[model samples]
Target: MTRFDIPAPDAAAHAAALERLDALVKPVGALGRLEELAAWLCAASGQVPPPPIERPRVVVFAGDHGVSRLSAYPREVTAAMVRVFLAGKSGVNVLAREVGAGVRVLDIAVDDDLSDVPAEVRAWKVRRGSGSIEAEDALEPGEAARAFEAGRRVADAEVDDGADLLIPGDMGIGNTAVAAALVAAALGVPAEEVVGTGTGVDEAGRARKVAVVRAAVERAGERVSDPFELLTALGSACAAATAGFLVQGAVRGVPVVLDGVFSAAAAVVAAEIAPEAVRWWLAGHRSTEPSQAVALKALGLTPIVDLGLRLGEGSGAVQAIPTLRAARAIIADMGLLADLG
Candidate 1:
């Protein structure tokens, strides 16, 4: 296991940024979430005014789940969406292009034979898809650790290539069900409270999903404090990989903006493994899923938007990038009140 010597973000820098923010011509908290967003950037990068994100990279880790067959959507949608992302036709691609950001799609565990994926976008495949947690562990033996490391390596390489900001997106049919199970087990909550109508399932489907999650949690035995074990037992390969990416983002001092419930569930595992990593994270948007809220609260993050978005594939996070850039502009260009005199 690669040891992550992640440090907490500098509190002094955050305080300094807040001090500067209070001196801006606008009234205190007038900018609302933007102020908080800017301050978080400062703290995250240890800069009084964080540098504008020049190379914002959105990486969608695509996988499949054995549980997808149980959901309303076809299991093949996961692979289909990977192709959409690669073609820059998905919501994430559209939003990234509009914000001057780049998108990379990873065929980490998609069930389709994505050998035709262009070299620039393809990543190592851990497997075709994870097992159904309703009956057994999601990953094969040793696969969990490998998935975790895959995520960390991808984040590290992106940062090495000068990516200033990272948005981890997910693409996997029935992933929300896996995420809901992880969240409920981690937080010791009931599945009914955490499970939502993923992909707009009908009431019967929703009830079935909830029951599946509850059974998975119960079958997993006692919740272990070890994050890797939790991931192997309850999370998809993409979820475990996402957790690894998030942990390494903080270790490398790069800020990470997390997308909806799947990302949030991975974040819960990341925080469990390294509590300090949470300091470098920002919630991009609030997903309509109740579990998303629970995961964010567990991480002590306030999301930048709340348009009831439940779309995964990093769409919600990518949509918030313009606002993030605007926040930077506000902190950097707003005149001081004293100067206004």
Candidate 2:
């Protein structure tokens, strides 16, 4: 029952950005989506031409879902990947380095001891693993609130540390199934439509995933109308935290770049909690996950790029950071046509 007061982005700044883009020494609308991106940054940051993205931080929320059977990989992979991320060996690390963004992985609900890990990563641990959604609620009473508050704190910490842009990533085995179930319940969509070949699941695995999603959504039932309830019923701790992180980013007036299906699913829940927060978010890329498309459509956001990226962990969002930088540069550094005289 945590509430967020998320104000909409600056409309006058958006208008001014559009005008400046039009006045640039280039054909109107020539920059295509880049122009749109520049305007969005201006609006979100309340600047006619937003400042350069000096520090983009990606926070990977790692967890382990009890419904491990739905994924091609076992549940332990979540913790292993968290270690890889911490070691700067994950795909997100490489891409984040390429884009000048820092990566931080948190163990939100990974079903592991992780006591030996750094305290910062395990500081927000909610539980070992969320309950199996198909048969039980994802979180116990009060756990959702804890996870959500953890996300909000993380957002504040990152912003205070000078993170100009935030990318929320996900790392959990069987998380795609959890996200699919959440999306189906939130959007009233069929499980088959939301389920995808997450973690390279085979056709049989996908069928089983769809069944799991259908059952979880059906179990959620009317609770889907309530964002927190829906998250507790069908979402994981990492997901709840991601939703909180996104909403807090808007509350703090910081822009967020959403990753793949997991991030998109969290975004749906975040939107329900604070509709105006959507204005501070941007779709970094089009994930091949069908549920991602459905969620993005619901949010009325067009992906900045579509490289067929299905990898989670903020890889796709990091890939789009350069493009975001270019968009800001175009607005900040491009010469005005009026200056030609």
Candidate 3:
């Protein structure tokens, strides 16, 4: 297993940020979660007022899942969407453009050659796609570590390139099935409670998906003790890599905005592996997926929005960027009561 030097968020900076917010010319708690966001950002950046985030980057990890053979969406759609993302034609692209954040579509394991995809997109293929967790281990031996290392390196590269904020998204067919297994195994919850209609599966399909998740969990059993083992047994490459991104974002002290259910699933594994990294994370929105709420509660994060969004390509997270910017603006532009008088 590869080593990760994860550290806790800065407590002194968090305190200073709260003090500054309290001194601002506003009611005791008018800002609500915005104030909390400002303090957390301050802790992340080690700044009292928190610097303006000029460069927000969204990295969408694309892959395919053998479990999709069980009927969530066409597995080929994963590669097709990667091409669309590379062409700047996906929901993530539109939202990222609206927020002035650059988007990078990374290929982890899409089960296709992706020859048509532009050369700029990052490619770190761990495998063509993970095996069906319903019957066997999702990832081969050591593949989980590779997925995680790929994510860590991507996070490092993004941060090194002046990206002040990170958004990790997912693009894979039947990922919700794998995500449910991850959540169920990590939280020790029943699979039926976490599984939901991913994409557009029918009721019968959903039932089958739930059964697959339950079987996957039962197959993994006690081996789920460690985060890596849980991922290898039930997580997709995209998911394992997203977990790495979360870990690396905290390790690098950069704020990470989580997307929908997929990102939350990765966060579950991340929270288990590095409990302190939760401080650097913020839920972008409350996805309609049932597992999303479970994962968020496990990490103790409140979503910035609850608009019933269930899109997976980081759209929800990008939608929340303006709120973060607004929080920063409040701290930077609002006049102090002492100065007003």
Candidate 4:
């Protein structure tokens, strides 16, 4: 089974981390989120002062969803959007430039044939995407394994390219429906709490989304309590890819910045599988998606960037990359008291 390295931080190392952080030439509470960053890095690395980063990597997974068939958005938008990403015109692309991060788009699913896999993408195309999930399971039991290995391959390549961190993203319309089903089943919350107006699905659209999820939850029966079972029931390839990245990342000890609802839902599944994996996931923003607040709370993660964003495509995740870099820069470059005093 896939997993993450989740051992508790050493008590002695914890003390040393506090000592080093206190010496950062400011009042104990002054640095705010930066202090949290330093401590988390310290705890994750089992060191007093975490090293600076170079070659940051962001892996954006673009997959087609079965739910899109029921939704208003057509499937063609996916490929067209991938084109935008390749053009470096998307928000994520712009932010990737800002953070000096390498971006790789992994195609695990799509409704139509995607030929000539773009050089900018890691083409792990899985059968022209999943068939409509409303009529059947999103992915077969074994197919999930194939999709997961694709994500693992992406993680390995990124790490080899000198990536010290991971930012995992997902792109798929009607994915919020998949995410909602996953949350309802995994967290034992009602489907209503998990459902959201994903990507501008107006009030009525969201109500319809909730009804769809409610039906799925009911059909899933007793097994709905198991997170993986739930994922198989309602999750899309994009959601699966994000979850796989989280699992792969934690197992390899890579810190990943999670985008909004879709990525966060993946984090929820991964955290259930590997509790230590939650430590690796940092929320980039609180999504405009209704369930984001509930989902993040369930995972005990607070978004460092609270931009009211609901757009998919990892816009939130890519944006947060700079914050991580900035945190490291302050610690690495700020003059030490011994150097100054």
Cα lDDT, all candidates: 0.88, 0.91, 0.88, 0.72
Instruction: Using lDDT as the measure, name the better of candidate 1 and candidate 2.
Output: 2
As for model 1, its CA RMSD to the true structure in angstroms is: 1.4
Q: Highest lDDT, which number?
A: 2
Poorly placed runs, candidate 1 (over 4 Å): 1-3, 119-123
TM-score of 4: 0.90
Per-model TM-score versus the true fold: 0.96, 0.97, 0.96, 0.90
lDDT of 2: 0.91
Candidate 3 lowest-lDDT run of ten: 114-123
Candidate 1 residue-wise lDDT at 305: 83
Give lDDT tens digits, candidate 4, residues 229-334. 6566667666766777887777777777788888888888777767777877788888877667777998898887877777767778777766766766656566
List the candidate 2 regions with Cα displacement exceeding 4 Å: none
Name the lDDT value of residue 1 in candidate 1.
47
lDDT of 1 by residue, 1-341 (tens): 45669877879989999999999998998998888888888888789788988999998999999789767789888888888887889998988898888998888888888767776555568988888998988988788789888999999999999999999999999898999998999988899999999899989998999999999999887844567788888888899889989999999999899999999999998888878888888999999998999999988888888888888989899878888998888899999999974
Could you give candidate 2's per-residue lDDT for residues 39-97 as a string of tens digits? 98998889978988999999999999989877778888888998899899999999899
Candidate 4 local lDDT, residue 250: 73
Tens-digit lDDT track of model 3 for 1-341 = 45567777779998988888888899867899889888887887877778998899999999989798765567889888988887899988988999899999888988988777666564587889889997899899889989998999999999999999999989999888889999999999999899998897889988998899999999999989899999999998889899999999989988999999999999999888878788789999999889999999988989998888887899999989999998888877888877885
Clashes of each: 0, 0, 0, 1
